[model samples]
Target: MANASARANSVTVENQDVALLKSTTVGRGPISDIAVDGDTVVTTNFGDDSIAVLDSDTLAVHGGVFAGQPTTVAVVGDRAFAAVSSASYDAIAVIDTVSGEVVKEYPLSFNVTAVVTSADGKRVYAGRSGEEGVDVAVLDVTAERVGTIYVAKAADATIDAMCLDTTGRRLYVGVTDSRSSRLITVDVETSRVRRTLEVGAPIRGLALGMEGVAYVLTSDIADGGVLYVVDLVNNKITADVAVAAAPTQLVLSADGTRAYVVDYDHVAVVDTEKRAIVAEVSVGARPSAIALGSDRLYVADYDGGVTVYTVAASTPMLYSQFASALAVPAPRELQPAV
Candidate 1:
């Protein structure tokens, strides 16, 4: 238990999820996807046939470029990659966050459901799904398809979600066929399957954590949803945390302590250490996507509305505590004056 002095200084953290909420609308049509980096937030507006970039703090529209039915988006540094997968268009539209212009396009032979990038924005990995099979396309920042990794061969198998580990050496693909669902981990260097685990339900989202842990969200009609904690190093599941019945996306914090899950009408906050839900935030309507920037949480509804909140993260909280503790005047509380 903390002392009374510590209690007096108990930082009033506004979730920083699980509290402190602000709602903002970006009217561009129903949002298909959302991604945030620094002070920028990008959303793919499928119905509007464009993407919208906004200031993360003010909810002000920065600028956006038009694309042909942008489905999903990812951001690395100042660049944003949107997967445009309409009937006539199948390409990766690259945009500059500051100018909000589609500077380049990488024509793709297939449609992608998930898009992720390397830490340095040098490479983009796209999850391609079709009737034939599913594979991951390795794309360089120069708007070129470098290579492809075969993820699944089952006829009509589709990749539901794709996540790259912190080290960027491992990629996890959640694929579901007509009969079963699976989580496949692949080595980036070798471009080979490292391990495959049966999930048995539709995978909604995936996020990697510290110490080789993978958090996967699976949705079931009858069973609702379950957040499975898997040990990547041991190749086993460590815990199963329940969540919403129908979920769309999952975004984990950089510290890997909390996971924000976008369910039907709310965001479920789960504590990784406790292996339980710490809070549920009401987002209203259908939440299509979610992203995290620093301690800020961005939840985008299918209707194109986004809500922002400041969630508690390990690094920021530690710094906040230390800074506060050090600001004590004259060391009155100092023990032994040592």
Candidate 2:
């Protein structure tokens, strides 16, 4: 009977293809960011000022909370941190993922553009950019504002996107300059600028990969676009690959072997080791953000809708079982615990 059970399990797994996973509309509005933690998928809606929580295994919208023009969202343990824009509240709202309620809101001196949590999930770094100045505020979740790092030279720079390395010791900030885009590396503990590398054109999105490697998507929004590979150790551009027109966002795979770039109306896969284009998947319409799960790639398109792609070494297939499995019953009441 044990052997028969093992055989049946193998057959069930064989029939489960990654491609079978359908991309469901977990929430409305333009998704600014999508983060997956265990079985939960949290998406920031820039259009509706809310954060939608979906079950990764079922693709069902478990619940959502009004987060106020949330431009970026990051999950560390049970807490979900959202960077609300100045147009809304100019603050970072903390939501409890388990209860789907706003537990705290940290008001910023300026517009908060991005928020990233530390590796150990003890602290959060919020980036504020506007007429006031470009600064990164460090928040101790257990306490309050412990310190603030001001990018004096970047006062005129528009801080757009930010990402941290695996160690959480280093942070890469994407700043838009008058003529080009600058990738600035900051020491998280010291909160000081370590290095600045310039990309010829303005960057719309940036992503950091393993081993101190950074990828920048140059979006001139007029002429064309390009992708620059930067080596953090040497603080230089190792390679530059020209991409499709108006590339918006860049996402790296889990292994850091490849990078997925969203252009005007398509998604291009780049081989990071070789620094070359490997596969160009036509997504149609403008793609907003790209996220990668265990073996699937999720693309949030501007108009065409979200698309999920199956990625694997052998016999790649999209699985939709997770989407349907996400329909857990909502709680009777969602209220602030504190």
Candidate 3:
């Protein structure tokens, strides 16, 4: 059924109100994580033991491969590392984006919940949450497992989210307990916690922007949810953007002016400078993952479907000083690994 809809040729959905570029079904349901590079789109189907791959240029499905219980994914160059953390085992499935096949796997003792890789595809950083203090597993592409980088304390702390900056030199780790949360910056070269910022709520998503500006999404029982704008350069929370009661995911636009957040049944577009929700796109099903690439918004839902949109945000494109960063970069094509 869902695959049948995707099996058919793609059709564009556009209206005066909704700028839907296209929509298609990937697999069964409940996509947990999604990653996009220059030429491909990959989603971890937590609803099943597989990951779906799609062609970025044509929006065509390239099928997928079995990845066990993949909870998170990070794409670098031609390879995509998916964190598989089922009760039976724990590993990272290295996938070839072009062939849609799992080429390799790196086994680990700790369960990886979130993963991100360097630009060169040489190193993979995985976030592990468990009884011990939260730690990041550093794995080499050629050597498998290498070492660990500790980030938070052990008193019931969990790694909620993690993001690598553009330079690939700095990492932002988000750790949360029942009542408190902290954002820790890790220096990748030395593997040390450089700075820590206290957050009032549980961190759900982490995204880095231009000029050391980080958008951290959090959820609170009393305050619902907020998109905390953190000035990493100054080490402070600049603004609190009230998004919704439970925002699950976040992605920033290529222009660095807008941030798209998944708020239950809708995707809220935020103005980074003004620190506000400027627009909300209502989805048919509850959204589980969201990503942006080359001016298109890709949203995965609980119904095993993905809707791509050519979002026309009402907010300003970028900060006046960063006007030259307006050109959107094309998706990276998966090439043969040397």
TM-score of each: 0.86, 0.80, 0.86
The true-versus-predicted C-alpha distance at residue 100 of model 2, in Å, is 1.5
What is the alpha-carbon lDDT of model 2 when measured against the actual structure? 0.67
lDDT of 1: 0.76
- Per-residue lDDT tens digits for candidate 1, residues 1-338, read 11213211111223434444566667656888999988899998887788989888877788998788988999877899999967775988899999989898887777788998866677688888866899888775553435777778977788889986555667799998878789999887777788999988888899877767888888888778889999888888888988777887888887788888887867788878887777777665567888888878887776667777777755532222332222111111112100
Using lDDT as the yardstick, the better of models 1 and 2 is 1
Q: In candidate 3, which residue ranges exceed 4 Å CA deviation?
A: 1-18, 312-338
Name the lDDT value of residue 193 in candidate 3: 93
What is the TM-score of candidate 3? 0.86
RMSD of each: 13.2, 10.7, 6.7
List the lowest-lDDT window of 10 residues for candidate 2.
1-10
At residue 211, candidate 1 shows an lDDT of 68
Task: Report how far off residue 281 is in candidate 3 (Å).
Answer: 1.4
Go through the candidates in order and give the clash count of each.
Answer: 3, 18, 4
Task: Return the clash pairs for model 1, or none.
Answer: 15-312, 16-311, 16-312
lDDT of each residue in 1-338, candidate 3, tens digit only = 13323423232223232365567777887888888887788989988878988876556788688777888898867888998867777888889888888898877766687888776677788888756678888776764435777788776888888987766667899888876898999987777899999996888988887777888999877887789889998889988879877888888875678888888778887777777777777557778898777667787888777777676543323443342333312112212221
